[model samples]
Target: MDKAQIKIYGLLENYLEYCKTNGFTDFEIWCEDNIDSANEKGLVQDIYREVNHIADKLFD
Candidate 1:
């Protein structure tokens, strides 16, 4: 992956950790805001969906 892709992935990984440690619902607003700011719409949606899923399992 390119630097930007790698960086975004890394950041998303960290975000996942944060969501996992906390709660998915707790991070909903942040996730929405991030998805808005993310320049890559496709990637953002993908990450948002994946993270939300992971967070949901943790929350459950």
Candidate 2:
């Protein structure tokens, strides 16, 4: 991958780890409270679906 992609992946991975280790796991409530736009929420849900698709294959 390119340098930008690598950096973003590293940052996201770290953020994911931080969230997992901390008490920020209530994603449904978080989204309900934080996501102000239905369009943005839909986009994020699409991302969740795509990520879960790959994760199910890779980690199953």
Top candidate on lDDT is 1
Tens digits of per-residue lDDT for model 1 on 1-60?
Answer: 855466567667777777667756533346444443445445665566666677788765
Report clashes for each candidate as comma-separated counts. Answer: 0, 0
Q: What TM-scores do the predictions have?
A: 0.55, 0.38
Candidate 2 residues 1-60, lDDT tens each? Answer: 755445445544644555556633433333444455566566446555454454444444
Alpha-carbon deviation at 57 in model 2, angstroms: 18
Residue 36 miss distance in model 1 (angstroms):
10
Clashes of 1: 0
In model 2, which regions exceed 4 Å deviation? 25-60
lDDT of 2 at 43: 49
Estimate the TM-score for candidate 1. 0.55
Cα deviation in Å at residue 43, candidate 1?
A: 0.9
